[model samples]
Target: MTKGGDEQLVGSSSADTAASSTSDVGLVDETKSKGNTTNSTTDPEVDQPEVKKGEVPRGPGPFFYIGGANGAGLVSVYCRSKGWQRIHDNKREDYKLKWCETKSRETYYNFKEGEQLLYQIPNNKVLTTKIGLLSSLREYERVMNKISTNLNPKHVEIPDPKVAAVMNPLVWVKASEKFSQRILKMEDFFPESFRLDIKDEKEAFFELYKDTQIWICKPTCSNQGRGIFLLKNQAAVKSLQARLQSIEEDPVYKKLPYKAPQARVVQRYIQKPLLLEGKKFDVRSYFLIACTVPYVLFFGHGYVRLTCTRYDATSDDLTAHLTNQYMQKKNPLYSQLKEETVWRMERFNSYVNDKFRQAKGLPKDWVFTVFTKRMQQIMMQCFLAVKSKLECKRGYFDLIGCDFLVDENFKVWLLEMNANPALHTNCAVLQDVIPTVVNETLDLVLEIFNKSLKGQRIVPLQTLCHFVLLHNGGA
Candidate 1:
């Protein structure tokens, strides 16, 4: 074992130093007899020094805890709690190193003595894993490639609709639509009343008329209540088309803030929405899958997000259509709007449990029995569809946020699925949901690592050390 001149072995036995050369450091079989002190017996011809029993031996490879800054820190806490040793820290910089090797390898030098850090792990190669915005459809492929390449240290990416569509081409819903349909089968899912007119001479409207009074105009790729307009009159349809065309033509619209150039799908609108205190709202039930196995374990608890304003199809009030935190804060209808009032998944579940229990004639298990059961089925379908298409398994997704609407009939219609579900604990519901989210995330990561390691030998120390430094702080 080569050590820097200034390096000192702390908390290590004398045997550790002598056995370091054996390449299995700090791992001794306790069942071995205590009388056998040295690794090597006296051989007069060779004149080799005897390996002492109390010495530390070098391990096969380095151990790392890799993730984003917050994730890395969380794992660090977890590892420390478990009393696991041989840990190193790094960040995305290490991953960049894997991609870009020609760039000069950085050398750390002490200004006064011209020496590197004494205790720095040496000859350890890095395995870098980056976690960031899966910004576009193209980035999805890039992220998946990185994940596949580094199989040891897993990557966690949060993908939006476009990326999710690229990974698994599924139908999405506009916020305005009461019922968002998942493409169970390309043929059967399309309504019998609807027809696809690819080359219709009249580009006046792509119409889905359930009845004369109700119509929904949905742009295929828009999200967060954007690019949707109800057609009350013929003029409204024309006006919407003109507006959409103008948006498509704008340079800025071609980039961020707009997902134009993508075709928009229009459907029939649901005029009647069940009101809570005369306010129209939707619940954002966050679903998570540890692994995309045939049988999946879902983290049930999620939050309900309420729109501050009452339902009005004609009104372009931000709060009316969007259940987003950003839009909700701006809406004046919510009497007590504070950052902390935001709820998490668990809190929302508890609230629902209590609220339904207190209601005059509601069933005893209204939320768990009816609401959550329906939500689970919808999510299971979505996950099954996604898993059937994608190759990789063992991912943590904020699966479908099933936004539902209860009509006068009290029938629930599935709304849009939010692939990249936001976990904000500003509300009590969100705050309570964080623990389950964290635990489920960790569980998935461990399961992936364990599965990958099953038929494989311990990774080389150099590689492991590199991953640790890169993942922890060396990035």
Candidate 2:
């Protein structure tokens, strides 16, 4: 998995294929086809897409997982599983690249003047602490997107997350109710989306995309699919709001809100997600921004999690609508769901082609190509949102696990952005991929931090992971 022996961290989320792992089934490539292309007609397999190269200063040191609560421990296990050593005693670590939040000490600490803790620690402890969690990306996306326009002359906007989030049923509905009267003009090439609310989102089902019936509502900042639910109409929607209000007002029900106590991100359900046998499934793509300063991104092959039960939006089954591993494990079908529930993109690709080769209404060939493009666009947008503002004072990088779903039309929809996606391997499938991914990401982080260090091996490195440079940290 090492990038040759050079270990040079060249800036890239858009990489020139240093290496690729093909044996792992279900793991798909995250490369973007460069030519003028649209969702409807792009050849995802366009060989030798335009690749660019640029050099950035790199730093050295071993990397480890931080934020132990949100899959950090799992990452640590994976790293150790791969023969990487863990820093048992924090005192001896030096020039060592460690990622920590406010809760850390000399390693990563609370920011206080005397103790050098709390708020101040994140300045160096973590990359840059956000008043908002990754889950709150909804409100802060503009801050991230603002980076591209402000820093780059090309003004190459990463449009997926920008489009996906803004077009969310909750966002547009609230906007139209508050700002519909005023018109916001657009450029010719910008993506198109309908400005609709919860009511409209639901009505779109019976009146527009008749195949869709229920709407999915989620708390803006949550994990393990805890606050997610399905809405049938105004009554259900009202009940949800009432429940939130009750939690907010009740003493036992509330502690503190991650973002807004009652806030939620809602969208119409994709009534027709492709089912694996009897179960409904969704894909999880991991996008690694090895270094934000130089704006390096990696769209690696990812794992997929599926529901335990057969697909049934009408059944009011939460497991069916939500396919995250955390949510799926709770169902009675969990035992049988193990091998069937999770998959690698490599296996997924094989299955899709073998099973759905001639299946009608499936945009089968373009799934990987389209899915990859969407993931890249979203990833770029995320970095753009925070690139300029991200205080990478000492090599602070983030690996985001983004979720997506493909409607029966094969039009992929960016579902939710998890600030802290879990890293638990409840099944055998994840053991093969997740740890390797963590190892690869750690390598990239080290490369970016030590790219300019003396006596480092620098070569045209080759590995399965492709590095894509979105914005230069030095720029």
Candidate 3:
């Protein structure tokens, strides 16, 4: 679809967005009483002995535990700032908050909701995994299509005006017309993707392949641009199929603890991408699911990552096509050109304003306005797609790194969502962004947790920092 089509859809759908926003606030209020039911509810007060107002309520010193090396230092520092002690033991279940890069079932089993906080939902793979996301989007699209079809026009005579108002399809359609118009179509943002592991999806991909088009094959769960390649013709597709078949047929491989990387996906590649200074790049944004029970979600800004080499549609080098920090680091001159590989969103906006604003007839500060809202809407749709299936609790929270690619036409496309996104402060831009992200994340977590525990409001958050609230699901 054209960019104009997307705008029209967004404009029409947005007609009901204001009403939806009002309803969301109403939902929080309506669920507040239900939210304070302790064990059975989302934001129940923990059972604690009453203490005098002047006397400091004391327990276990409000201890916190850090589980992995991803962002341990920053987390520890943040905990210290809150006057919370850090426990080195991973097995302990007494910690008030636990932030781990890797999910642990034991920790979750012992988690004390309403009294503690945990990072990451246990079943986040539904949105994190490549194949998992694709499946969810496809299923959501099918369901939405069915609903739309059922709402189609049908003629029926009614004896009474009130009965007609209640039973007539036109009445129902008029009521939901704006809402139906405001939603995003799955194909509008997500690229055409097929799971190679599924026989039917694989065959469909093969049938859809053409010599003129480029398809990118990727491992479903792998990150850092690993195990990715381009399929330019029939030969590459057949070769990949043979390799997968061989891996599956290898009984010897099955006996081992680790299996071969047979679970893969082939996505239609964006041939003409919006390049910055002639180098391919992608925006790395964030989706924060801060609270699961009465879900609270936010969108945060992130820096852009560019390839080390210039754009080349027919380039044999993968570095030119993949705009990831890990891919860029592999180049021999990376050490000298590292500064050029990353750009802060402000810098990026300035560059675009200077170069393409008038030429493309874009609005002033288009990055902060149009592009930012577009990314948030896409993320909201993705969350709504898998919201019900996600495992939720009072304490569980998650932050997902969402990557997006803009075509030459300025249309945004969601590439993938990554759980436990890279927090390395290796580059100058990262050094400035990652720390703020971590600090603000903790600030919001603590603020909301305290309010929720005290049966207060989760909206009107004071420590939102750079985060924008996307969904306020009652707590």
Candidate 4:
């Protein structure tokens, strides 16, 4: 398949259009009713009744609404396969499922909790934005540390000797492990980060800064490697600090939100990243919050995004440093070398096996085993970090795109999480991957939603395809 143009993220301003592949299906326009139905009390096609009290009656139905064109093709195909009719109007609240690219306040305000399947959980920025993630992680760390201190052996109860004889003596150890399992050590997977907007955090970064160190500065709310640059010298860091300080002091800038720069975070750059065939790359994986009621989560494999040119630490071009598809597309050789820019997980696993298996003392299938588990653990840690803070409802679900970096030492580091990941079938690998991810996402969502509506248990999900179960908060 020839690589077409890339698609926009969830909150992007791109115009929404019906999937060209689904041209045969009728996607009823919201602005104009199908002829003669404008004055009718109910639409005969969907059989939806007139609104009462701003809510539709609760029940499973065969109507879906896709708010954008990014992944609309696969979503439409999936809905069509299930004989579900598509709802074209974004304002229509009667749809059984609404997959909106951008999260809107109106959607949540009008949400019929248990009756509708909404795509994103409200207030998910707690884990998605750079500053939000950093804050949540720090706050979570503080809470967990306090709890762990209380759970120390010194505070443990002294068991009866006679009763302890038959029971496992490692009760406290098990308890501690159980608590720790929910959140991994941030240092183990996440790079050190500091928020530039906060004064103390900014000073702390400068205090810890070294002449030889490198830091990658990024915008808090942006994606696709936009406004990301490396700080290799003290001058670069100071310039950034001065610029931000000026902005903070500018009353006019503060009042004009549209002109103000977004908040930012500077992360210690992974200087020794492992390269594939001399090109820098990063793994793009899925962290799906499939169900929020009791929280059913999954981890799905995503293809690797590799830089077009050979990686060079001294290179000033961002295309050499940033491995995102958007960054790579800027290179002149992108169209010719496009095929080498993306690799399926299996290809990555095989390459690692052949190249670094013996040399690095890695396992035969290290990519699928150790590396995968590391990613899962990191993702779980991030989820648990903001689990309590996230706004949850029965109908809400989320699919976050998680970026990971593998160092030369085989250490996995979580870079950042994106709310609305791109689902463009731009290349051969995306064509093979994106559709499956969306389909399985819908499959599991429908299964859980339908089962929950019928008072059925949420476990033993029969529709879980390639997605691996991370956490099942039960029915």
Cα RMSD to the true fold for all candidates: 21.9, 16.1, 12.5, 9.6
Question: Residue-wise lDDT of candidate 3 within 1-475, one digit each (tens)?
Answer: 0001111010000000011111122221100111111111221111123332234335667877765455556777787777777665566677889876655557767888888999877667777778778877887778876776556554334678887667857565774576577678878999888888778998888888888999999876667776799998888888987897788789887786155553788999999999999999999999998887778889999999999888999997998998876677778877788888999999989988998899999999989999999999999888878887777778888878999998988999999998777766677787789888988888887787787778888978999879988888773
* Candidate 1: residue 41 lDDT (0-100): 19
Best by lDDT, which number?
Answer: 4
Could you tell me the C-alpha RMSD of candidate 4 in Å?
A: 9.6
The Cα error of candidate 4 at residue 124, in Å, is: 0.9
Ranking by TM-score: 3, 4, 2, 1
TM-score each candidate.
0.49, 0.59, 0.84, 0.83
- For 202-245, candidate 4 gives per-residue lDDT tens digits of 99998888879989998777666767999998998889878987
Clashing pairs in 3: 13-182
lDDT of 4 at 2: 15
Write one digit per residue (lDDT tens) for candidate 1, span 48-159: 2322234432343223322212122233344334443322222212211011000111311111111101111111101000000001112333544454444322232435
Per-candidate local distance difference test:
0.36, 0.47, 0.74, 0.76
* TM-score, cand. 1 vs. native: 0.49
Candidate 2, residue 372: how far the Cα is off, in Å: 1.8
